[model samples]
Each structure stands twice: as C-alpha cells, then as structure tokens.
Target chain A: MKLTKFAMAAALLTSIAFTSCKPKDSEIKANVEAALKADMKMANTVVDVNDGKVTLSGECTDAECKAKCESTAAGVKGVKTPVINNLTVAAPVITTPPPASTATVLDAATQQKVKDGLKDINGVTVDFTADKAVIKGTVTPANRMKIMQILASAKVQSDVSGLMDKK
Target chain B: MALQDKYAQLLSAAQTHGVENLSVAEQNGVLHVSGTAKSTADYDALWALYGQIDPNMASGDLMMNIDVKAAAGAQLKVTTDSTNLNIRSTPSTEGEVVGKAAHDEVVTLVEKTDDSWWKVRTAQGEEGYAYAQYLSPM
Candidate 1:
C-alpha cells in the first residue's frame, strides 16, 4: 500500500513540473516588447507573443528588413519561434495641403464689410475672390473713396476703369 | 525692448505650436534662438518671421537653430486592435497607402508630423506616415 501511494505522488509531481516549465503568455509578451523597444530599426513594428511563438507585423522597407525584425524578436528570451506576415516593402506616402496664402488668411467679416460698402454703387459689384478684391462696373468718386477705405487692408484690383481719374 | 525681446512674438508662436526644447538668449547684439519644431510648417513659419523681422536676412545677428522633431530614430511599437494599420505617403486618409504595419510590429519612428501623423521607418527602410493614435512610443 505504501508503494502504491508513493507511485501516485510521483505521477502528480511529474505533471506539475511540465506545467511550470513554460513561461506564461503575459511574461513572454513583456519581454518581447522590451527587446524590440531597444532597437531603433524595429521602431515601427509591433510584437505579440502566444505560447512562446511571436508574431511581428508592420511595415518593413524590404524583405531583408522583415527577416531582421523576425530574427530580433526570435532572439528575445522566452520566445520560441517568430512568425512574420504581411510586412510590406514600400515607402509611406505623404500628401499635405498647400500652404495657406495671405489672401486666404483674411477673415470673412472683413470681406463682408468690403462687399457691403460697395453695394449702393450702381452696376458695381465688389467681390473678393482668388486673393483679390475685385471691383466690377462703375463707381462715383465718393463711393470709390468709401470702397478704398473699407478695403484698406486688402490689395484692391479693379475691373471697372475711369472710376478714379485725376481730373 | 532688447534684441532678444524683439523676438518675443516668434517665441510665443513657437511655444504655442508645440516646439520643444526652446531656448532664447541674447549676447553681443545677437539673438540666439533654438527649438525643435514639430512640423515643416512650423519650422517655415519661424524662418519666415525671422525674415520679416530682418529683411533679406541682412542683419545676420539672429542665430536661430530650429530643428524639426521627427521620429526618424525613435523605437515605436504598433498597437492596432486587429486590422492592420495603413501607412500612407501623406498624413491624410486620402493619401495613397504605400505600406502596412501589422498589429504589434516594432518600427522606428522617423518623425511626428504635427500631432496627427507620425512618420515611421520600417526595418527595411520603408518610410511613411501612420496614424499617431496607433503608435506607442518606447
């Protein structure tokens, strides 16, 4: 009976040893993260570990770089195998809007003021477009002076001629 | 106001734009300004202001060193929920996608363009912009 109990105890200890031998999944992930962070070349890559197998995914400039990243992750402690997938070897595209010109910076309130001041002028329409204060049709001398005053801060361009002739 | 104090407006603008490591000093009629601009736009604005203050750079008294802060050599890990993060040439979604980063990949940060886009260089030297939200600095 003593021998039978001893055999059962030995079997239980053997099972416990096998279970404790492998590192937990969380612990493996932490180590992989730390290892990858130390390397500048692996900056854009992400690391995930599951049951000691690591999967690296992100943009890679080339196939060789991807291999390097895989190897780096594999070298980390507690990682048994490195799996690489969908690593691309292409450059990132950067498309930015053109810089805003000085004309665009002018506020709408100021533009409206210029338009309101020129409303009473006969056959004359004042519009601010394409960075210019456009004055169309004709204006009296007094109205022209008012337009100038309202658009004092803007660059005035006139389509209508003979509005301000020195006579 | 002193010569350095004359640049207070520019300094204030730079700080508001998130320029890092800002330093301003005046000595021998020279204003030495140094800071790290977050984007090329901010960098250009600083120089443009400098030009306006001193036309044609004639004075040569202002020594300004405004460096663009890029993630060029920074180590960053990818953090996507499941779908791969798109790496585009431009910062906007309309930008053409040149590459992709799988979830949990470690990549080098080339630069952070503004706060929205991060320029990252992959191990293969592939460089592009990724959404700043997905990249975790290490």
Candidate 2:
C-alpha cells in the first residue's frame, strides 16, 4: 500500500513541475494583448502565443512604431525572448498641391520695380513680357540669388532660361 | 506636387525654424514660398539648404522670398562685400548719395521705405535711405 501511495505522489509532483515550467499559451496571449493595448498605434496589432513564444503581426505607421510593438510584446511576463515581429510599415501618403493659377501679367510699374532692383547688379538685364520677366545675363551665384529675391519681392514672375552662370 | 516633394526638406525646415506668416503656393509651374525668418542666420541657413538641394538653384522651379524679421529702430549690420553702403536721399538709385556707412557698421533702421530700400541712421547721426539688400538685421 505504501508503495502505491509513493507512486501516486511522484506522478502528481511531475505534473506540477511540467505545468510550472511552461505558462498556458492562452494566458500568455492575453497578457501580451493587455500590454500592447497601452499604445493606440498597437490597436491593430494581433498577438499570438504558442508554447510561450509571441508573434506580433499588424500594420504599423512607421519602422519606429513597428519596433515599439515588438518590444512591448517581448516585455510580457510569460512571453519568450525574440518575439516575432511581422509588422509592416504602411505606405506614405502623397498629397497633391492645388491647381496652378492663370498666367500673371506684369504691369509697367512692376517691370520698373524689377529694373530698379537690378541696377546695382552689373552684367544683368531684364525685359518684361506679358506675364514674366525674361532675364538674359551672366551672374554670379550670389547675384543670381539676389535677382530671384528681388523678382519675388516685386511679386513678378521670371523666365531666367536665358540667364547664364558667370564663370 | 513634384516640386513640393523636391523641396520638402526646405519647407520642413521653414516650419521647424518658426517662419512667421509662411505662405506656399504653386502657380504657372513655379513654387513661390514667402515668409519672415526669425533671424538673419535662419534666412541664410535656409538659403544654404536651398543651394544644397538644388545646385546653384539652377532648376528655377522654386522662388524663396524669405525676409528677415526686423522692426523700426532695429539694429542692422552693413553686409556689403567690403564696400561702403551708400546712403541715398531717396529710395531709388536715382536718388542722391547723402552719406556712407562703412562695411560692418551697425546702423539703426529708420523705416522700411519699400522692399528694396530702407531709411537708416548711422552712429554719427547721418540718416538716409540704403539698399535693403546690403543691410542685415542684427
């Protein structure tokens, strides 16, 4: 009778040891899900636990967000190390600019403004057409910037295609 | 939009640097950006970034009309390339030269007569209009 009791005790101890060694997969999944819930970005992330290993799969806004989700999963108490990160970075959104306005006309006053602005910079000449100033001259990079700034300040459009870089 | 993407970093920097009254528009296939930079350093940095993005700004697709912030009575430094800034009696080159502010001289802004000219006064009490291009806000 004593021998049978000893055998039963050994069997119970072995079962307890196995249960303590590995947490239930369902419990681990719930824990990881709870941890990931802290971040709104992780709301779409799906958590799966199998044999204490956690696998996170979802779409993250960016690489940084994806890595954050993986780390969060790995930090769960029952989760195994090196959590599988199958998150994908969503494609960036492209926005279109507003439509172009009709061609602008440069009045004589505006043209004279451009002329007055360019008087200081030598080797440059400007001719005002219907809508834009057609400039043709060789100008240093500094002078080129100055011309552009001056034209902008005058609110006049320019066609500098004829302008050449000063050597 | 392509032009906007090409100049994305520049626009982003403008926002990061706190450019006031910033306005960006695309018209006639040209990108026009205008704003007031907080300082001359910010304006120069933006220009340098522009040159870096577009070598010598040859594309001619972007028109950056950034102005440095300054008020009446603000201190301005003469930024001419080692030349005395001619203070004129009027806002135009046709105006008579009244006084001269040496290179690197700090002058007080009297008024922004226009985009291309400003009325300024020197330490020696000489007051006249100077080309706005050669005066940088200190």
lDDT, candidate 2, B1-138, per-residue tens: 988999999999999999998889887678888889999999888988998998766676777878899999999999776678889898777789999999999999999887778999999999999888788998
Residue A162 alpha-carbon offset, candidate 1, angstroms: 24
- Model 2 residue A74 distance off true place after TM-score fit, in angstroms: 94
How many backbone clashes does every candidate have?
33, 0
CAPRI docking class of candidate 1 = incorrect
| TM-score per model over all chains | 0.26, 0.61
Q: Write the per-residue lDDT of candidate 1 for residues A1-167, one digit (tens) a residue.
A: 99999999999999889758877778877877677677676678877766777788877777777777777777877778636455666676789774211113335654554453344345666655554466655544444443443343222232333243223
CA lDDT, candidate 2, residue A90? 98
TM-score of chain A of each: 0.42, 0.51
Compare the candidates by TM-score and give the number of the best one: 2
Task: Report how closely model 2 matches the true complex, as a DockQ value.
Answer: 0.20
Model 1 lDDT tens row, B1-138? 477677778878888988998877665465666676777568657767765765434343555655556556877777555567778888666579898888888888877774446799887677898765456665
- Please list the residue runs of candidate 1 whose C-alpha ends up more than 4 Å from where it truly belongs after superposition: A1-13, A61-64, A86-90, A94-167, B1-138
Worst 10 residues of 1 chain A by lDDT: A153-162
What's the distance in Å from true for residue B91, model 2?
1.9
Go through the candidates in order and give each one's DockQ: 0.01, 0.20
